[model samples]
Target: MSFLDGKSLEPRDEAYRTHEITKKGLPLSAIWKGDANSISQLTVFRHFDSASVSEGFIGEGPNTVWVIDYPTLERIYYDLVVNFDVFGSVSHQILTRMYMDYLRMESEALFLSFLPVADREPILKHWYRGALAQAKVFYGHSHLLIDTPAAIHYGGKDPKNELIRMIGTRSMRSTHSARPTTNYVPSDLKVLDNLSAKKSLWLRYLPELSYVVVHDDHGEITNVISMVVNRAHANVSFIFGEEDRRIPEEDTLMLVNGLLGSYPNFIFWIDQSEIGKFADAAKQVSDTKSMDQWVARYGVRRTDPRIWSVLDRLHYYKQHYYKQKDGESEGLLDVSRYENL
Candidate 1:
């Protein structure tokens, strides 16, 4: 029989028969007290550690009824036995719940990659349905729950100042409604090269521009913009490989400084293993403040809130699915932790 068909039968019939509970010596008197002739059949069952009898009664003599609510009983027993929380001790319940939530968010983010970008909004809206309600529980004001975009325009004569002002203004804005009017042109590469060349400490760890973010028609990397100002941690993270594949510390620091010049409050994160490389590079360069002021390192602990937030953001941007080469870890928290749970 199908599992659904088995489930449809009364629990007592199939469960009792399968277990041969009559051998356990459960008295039929516990099931019903009725007319002797009315007694049709008797069955006994063991559920968890408790035993009970199910008796078929047709007519009443000295009618007394006994009922065992197995489902509710089992739930109560399991909760008491498995979920008992001790006083003055930390409970894994909260951490486990948060980890599960992170996994759910990651899964939702991955699913978005399968959809066309144009169709993503409606799906995202549906998925974030109760977010406002949940936010309301924590924040007293309704205005705080709503997202409002800010606008800033940069119009100046100096090219360097204009570029800095434009990025800083955009970084300050709460939402990005339009793509940047300025593209990362070939001339912009000269600008970055010139800026790095002037700085004695700039390690030229430039990866291909494509590796940073996929550009749209306007040549703007929207995902990078979104992730740099992500609400959860307001941190940007980079994962590097060992030896040859490792991103240059100079390039990472330079990028961090450029972003920090615009958003002073932003944090930058790197893999825990790469911290020594950055430190060693920092010793050679005079710009040690960038590393000290904004940088943090993280390991593989899935329970770390910052790591969880970073993974969620990266997954949302479709940046977490890249294949790793030999001797390189993806720096992603193991999703199997939640899967196993």
Candidate 2:
């Protein structure tokens, strides 16, 4: 028996509307509507988990078939890679290679497959925090002291951004003291002592120099330390620097656990390295053959419905609420829309 023989893959109720809206911009939908025909053949297959398949099936069975030209299918693949932020550049390349390999193995056009969305916020957050912590551990020899004016001007009200900007700013006027040696000492080893010292310094000089950025050298800037003062409480949140290198999963997990034990409140951002590491680890742990296989097998199951809902709302915003430019519009999508996703 086929894997999808008894299963209904059709969308239900609101999901049907969501499906239709998402398909509007898809290449497969365009091909089905006869908008373009540049391919020799296109084939759609339903992905199924082998574990869920009945014993009689050869492997996981495919269902919900669609046939189009090869050129059309290739166009769809390119469209997905270009339009979707769902996969990073490396991941996109991997997917493209996987598609080609699968096509070669099966001797048919590989067209459409279902992918579930996953909630990556927590994992991303953890990874980001770990990067910051790791930066401090690996590169904490140089320190950059930023004056209050630069911190205020660049960061505005956000303490985190203010701290990051203070370190990131290229202007020399904002930099009170560049690469202060004494401050480069590892503070994590003496966090309590450093906190007390920081508090005292804040009490005396909080109004003058409110932020600081610490680094090892001026080369690649793999790590940087930032600090913001809380004037009212006469306290400081010592923000560790971020690293660009891909930290191992075990290292990140250990670092996070260690940091949590040391500092109750630690701030970090999920850098590309951590994100890539997490994705690789997830692929390894998954029962599927590859990252592409995992996506095919569980993409829809991991997909967050809120993405579709937000897209629908954004469409509404663009149509009814957004201001028009000469009866036309510019790109309606913003980076903020994918912040939580």
Candidate 3:
């Protein structure tokens, strides 16, 4: 509750102090209607508690969630906040970036704990597509991780996505959140998801995050969604040649309900009537010229007569409607990166 906006906690006893704290002061439901069902299944863990669930940590990948612990948590705080210097020399910057790679791998390893033992290495290998000998070996040899088998069992061939599904069902069973965690609502997102699976360049032209305002056939606003493009990386190990590490054909996409991310690279307005065509057009995007034409069709450009009006309505819906319904804060979204397209 301390983490969620409009949610809070107070000691029952006014005189209570940190030294006097002995157990959890609130139940899991007080925090989440049902939180961490997958984690609570871990009966082998001796020190697991509701406090750990309250931490509310998550990993980088689609299905990867987390419960951060003290040492690594401290290291994370120090690694980026204390040890890093924005004004440092090029070598210093390179070293900082290099250190972050191993930290990311550790976080990824925590996600690996939930997968079936046999599937773990294979999935990780895909994540590290072009990783060199040392980078590949580093994950298996890490002292920071333990081989904790998942308490949950799987029955399907696709356990990775199955686990992801279970997590969503359990966590969202009681919340009033009007959002989709993964996959996507419209068929468009599924198209992007499927194309990525087949190693298509479907997501290559999209920015890191794009805001989409969907309207009904009657021209009434229906929903606002964000398209998140996750560019596939062969390896983050090497300090240079970022272009070489990129896997454009395998780039993937995620669509989340409501506003997401700090910088929205593009803002798009689409009537529900043309939404299907939009996805089809995205799948067929072959080059920059094609993308420009597509943008001209759906995008709200800087020169659009109603540009500010469109932005205002997006903000109005986010602050007045979504914020009240979801209990999630709706802060100002950044548009400094808005695409001229």
Candidate 4:
């Protein structure tokens, strides 16, 4: 049977909304409009003993639906990727390729169906023409499409402009006209130093990534990291420096204040320095339950067990990862040592 078959996929029909409570005391029925719960129901179909749930609010006021599933949401995601061509836009195709590099049969099969026809055309041509640069451009385009946020989400935040600056140097090597071709000056060292404020578009979105680089004793950036809190919107905390293994107090204060002041959404990067500080501050709030306080501090949207598990995993990496001799040996960094930690 189809995934939605057993539980009729029809919209829940009830004026006051019929209620069926899960063991946890949460409602299992749909209420009001746009409830993602009604849209996607969770079910187990295999030997995999674990799964996660997801839910989203559609209309206004006190009604909503609960959507549940595995953490990866693999089934639904595969459907979306296979169906959406826009995912492989010239801007992000390259990044998408790299993101999928590690996937095996099931994952690769899902991604192969996502590339646009036009995107397919160039690669096909390159196969015949044997032009290596053309192939690189195809990959580059995919990279930008997946790595960068959409234009509508910009809200004058200049996502493209910032990327043009941050990656302009390396981008220059792709092709004369590959990226940052026109009026896009590479962001200089000075720009990187004073990036305290970030622009967010509307209340719904924030930057998906905020990157910082800390240089080593040799004056080379030895540490580079991205702070991400939102996927659809892009609110990121980016800082770079070598001497201190701590996010600057000003940056921390700024981020907290910005989150508390802005819309309900708050996003931040949780790197070693920040995680270390978090552990320290978490100690101060020890009187309170650690797990509960940790969730509150991170402002995680879901309290679901699987999501909590991922958060716990993050905590595990934070605490135990450093003790190890090589962070890279643990399925971590493969890029520059700056990115290794």
Candidate number of the best TM-score: 3
Backbone clashes under 3 angstroms, per model: 0, 15, 0, 32
Candidate 4, residue 291: lDDT: 38
lDDT of 2 by residue, 42-91 (tens): 22211110011111111111211223345434645664566545546876
Among all windows of ten consecutive residues in candidate 4, which has the lowest summed lDDT?
253-262
Q: State the lDDT of candidate 4 residue by residue for 1-341, as single tens digits.
A: 32213122122212112333322121212111222113221211111112212122111111111122232245445544863467468536544443333222122211222233233334334222333343334334333222222212222343323322323333333323311222211222222221222332121122222233222343332333333222210111112222233222212101100001111222223343344554344334333355346545543333333334433343344334334522332333211211101
Per-model C-alpha lDDT, please? 0.29, 0.26, 0.58, 0.27
> Candidate 4, residue 20: CA error in Å?
9.1
Clashing pairs in 1: none
In candidate 3 the C-alpha lDDT for residue 210 amounts to 80
Compute the lDDT for candidate 2.
0.26
lDDT winner between 2 and 4, please give it.
4
What lDDT does model 1 reach? Answer: 0.29
- How many residue pairs clash in model 1? 0
lDDT of 1 by residue, 1-341 (tens): 32123232245333433454322222222222223233323332221123333332111111111133344335344544556454424445443333333323333332232233443345444434435343223222211112211112224433223322333344324233232222232222222222332343333321121112223454322333211111111111111222333223322111211111111222224333333453344335344455333232312233446545654554444433323211222343234322100
TM-score of each: 0.18, 0.14, 0.66, 0.20
Q: Measured by TM-score, how close is model 2 to the native structure?
A: 0.14
Write the number of the candidate with greater lDDT, choosing between 1 and 3: 3
